[model samples]
Target chain A: MTTSSYVYYPGCALQHRSHAYEVSNQAVAKALGIELVELDDWNCCGATEYFSVKRLPAYALVARNLALAAQAGTEELVVPCSACFLNLHKTDSHMRQHPRLEQAVNEALEAGDLHYKPGSVRVRHLVEVIINDIGFERLGQLVRRPLYGLKLAAYYGCLIVRPDNVLDDVEQPMLLDRMIEALGAEAAPFSMKTACCGGHMTQISETTALEMIHRLVTNASVSEADAMVTICPMCQLNLDVYQDAANRMFETSYTMPVLFFTQVIGLALGLSLEALGFGQEFVSVEPLIEKIRDVPPARSKPERRPKQALPMPAMPQ
Target chain B: MNATRPPTFFDRVVAATPDGERLSQCLQCGTCGGSCPSAADMDYTPRELFAMTMAGLEEEVLASNTPWFCVSCYACTVRCPQEIPITDLMYTFKQMAIEAKRFEHRSTADWSESFVGFVEQRGRSFELGLATRYHLFHHPAQVFKMGALGLNMLRHNRLALRPKSIRGIEQLRAILDRAKVLAEKEAWR
Candidate 1:
């Protein structure tokens, strides 16, 4: 088996606002024996609006980072943020599809002395990497502190699962659910799994943004999950930092710690709260972590469904 | 003159609006109104506005201050059970309303102007220009405090004093012109 390692693109939010995500992601990956190589000269992903405002420059902004990743000789780029993953993936796809866009973007990149040919690098989400490459069996093996009795609401925010091309499934993505289950935690059956967590909309429109966040948090809280597990930094921020504001806006009392899946994985891997940057969250994970710590390891149960043989058709004489 | 004049229908307000997809998919769950941070201050809810627009109540849709009150947070769109592009629709409607001179919000106009200034000067949003323009427009006292911060940022080599323009300004102008024409066509109806 060829051992796979990936170049990690932590994007701007991970570097600044969601530093806990980077910390947890790195620690968990290290514990699992997967090497996460941080990209050397990565920049902002230009986000969702930049492309709409100015297409060529947005492509160039994303392409510059891709070119850097390619130059570093890494074929696979693993992005933890859904918005970054979408921006990077869309830029790559669009550049390959449209030669004019590619040329203009490359020309802009010339100033930075970086250039990338479209399709040269593959962009993969962290969830996809863990579910596909690491596999459930391997993940199961790495679980020293199995998250038994911990009910988790797997929140896959809009950017990752939208546009259909880069996402696993638009309507119902099971990747996060499966990963949570692999950690020995109960994945709460919630319908708002693929809902949008108002991205930078919090800055542009507070009322509208709060409403969006209120629904996601309310659903997760109502699901009775100890904490909401997410893959994207923006999703984590909107749900975590904005929870209080959203609650106040709605005049509803609700508290749910929003955490990156990596942090949960770190806890499951026997890493300490300090290692996972647990205390860094605005919505305290201390109480939830204590609950997680109390639970015993999950007991292996036999398969419920009986093995059935394929029915053969009777031949007519 | 009154009898000869053609009656303006509700659809006229909504006709040729750019963000029809967002308006069409609102689920009327009241999640938007319930969660909106500014809902206490604003008159109409995003859900209600969407309902009105979908019902083709154009004059009410355009004349109402709901669109201007939107902060563009993806919260509603994100939490939307139907996954409507509520913010995008607001942006489109706000732009249309401004072009028609039917509604005017000074803060929004200032924001748009600052954005345009940034793009025209540096081919991107420069922090200094944005901050200065915003403070100048809204609160001039903010300029002194921001000036101190700007100097500190410059000292740390964060803010670039000289703005950099893209290579093809003419091409950018042509694209902007095309977009303006499209906006005008959408607004007139």
Candidate 2:
């Protein structure tokens, strides 16, 4: 049996912006006997821009971390942030394919007294690790309280699915949906699984960002999902914190809670809402909390009435 | 930056972009343009640019000043309903443009030159050198205004007066030269 242990790179957001993600991820991993080792002196993954701006430096930035992970003796690195995972994975792929880029980046690394050989460590998303390494069967076995009637819409976003190199099937990815179902919740059918959330666009431009967010939330809500479940911190923050603003911007009424997949796993493991960082969310999860314990009744159609009065009038005439 | 031979058209196209999918699935809903912070200020939309690229209207897309204006906030990529990687495409296009010598924003090129100079001299970015170069390029007057502040920062050891070179400067140069050659060849292809 492959033990559930891997190096965890929470990236920048989880460390500063979304502390709840980190706390919940750790608690859930610990409960599942998945040891998450933090990389020593790991720097930023350049937040998805540096590589595009300058290929060599971007490679160097990600390569520095890969070298650190290699030194830590971890064969695989588990990244929680979608952007970090993409950047790290892209760097690994590009370095192997482009020798000149690899040599240039390694030279930069040499300046910092660090060296990284291509394909030294495999970079993976937390969702991939949880779904592949920790099988759904094992997940179901660990579930202390099965969320029988809770409805969840799994949101994958773009980074994890697109480019197809670092991801699973782009058209239909069942990892998150499977995980949600394993937790004993009904995975609601929704179409915007691989859609973009207009990340940081919320900071740069609000109107367009809100619309993108609005579509995701409305789709999930219309699908009758109680909450939106996600794997990326950026996606979670965008959906959870920006839901109200997105609603106000679009002038629509939508009250949906965005919960991290780990948080849902934690809840299923009988962990308290506090430990899951449920209170830190901008949109109140109180309504979701109520639903968690009490499942809503299934919708039923009304019975049709008989048309006897019309027949009696016709006979009299 | 050292003067190098001009890149070929194909190399130019390849260098201008990061590795990613193109905008074949774009819905042309204008969401990317509408969401882009720089869209209001630019002549072309991200959708149009992608269309032109796919259509092989390379001259118009590459020659346009649109690529330089991208802030790289990834707003367009995120809001794209079709899941088109707009920002990455923009990056690729910009890189291709720079390598092809079609549209290198002088200001950004100057910054790149100064930054590379600093890195070649010092293993990492030197704050003073960076600030000096930035002021020289963007606003020379700011340097004079903050002279006293700059002296105070140096006195307090907040800024290093002498920039240190990386230990294997020769190897670093050789690596950079090889990258330049590869980029040139890629642009030509």
> Which candidate tops lDDT?
2
Lowest lDDT sum, 10 consecutive residues, model 2 chain B, at: B180-189
TM-scores, all candidates, are 0.66, 0.70
Off by over 4 Å in 2: A1-3, A165-167, A294-317, B1-10, B16-88, B94-189
lDDT by residue (A1-317, candidate 2, tens digit) is 33467888877667544667888999988888788988765666665444434555556666777888987898899999888888888788878977766776776666656678889899989888878877999999998888877889998877787554355666567789988989888888887777777665553345657777888898998888999888887888778767877777788878888888899999899999989866667667788766664443454445567755544435544
Predicted model with the maximum DockQ: 2
What CA RMSD would candidate 2 show? 9.7
lDDT of each: 0.69, 0.70
Look at candidate 2 and tell me the lDDT of residue A61: 60
Q: DockQ score for model 1, please?
A: 0.07
Q: Tell me the interface RMSD of every candidate, in Å.
A: 8.2, 8.2
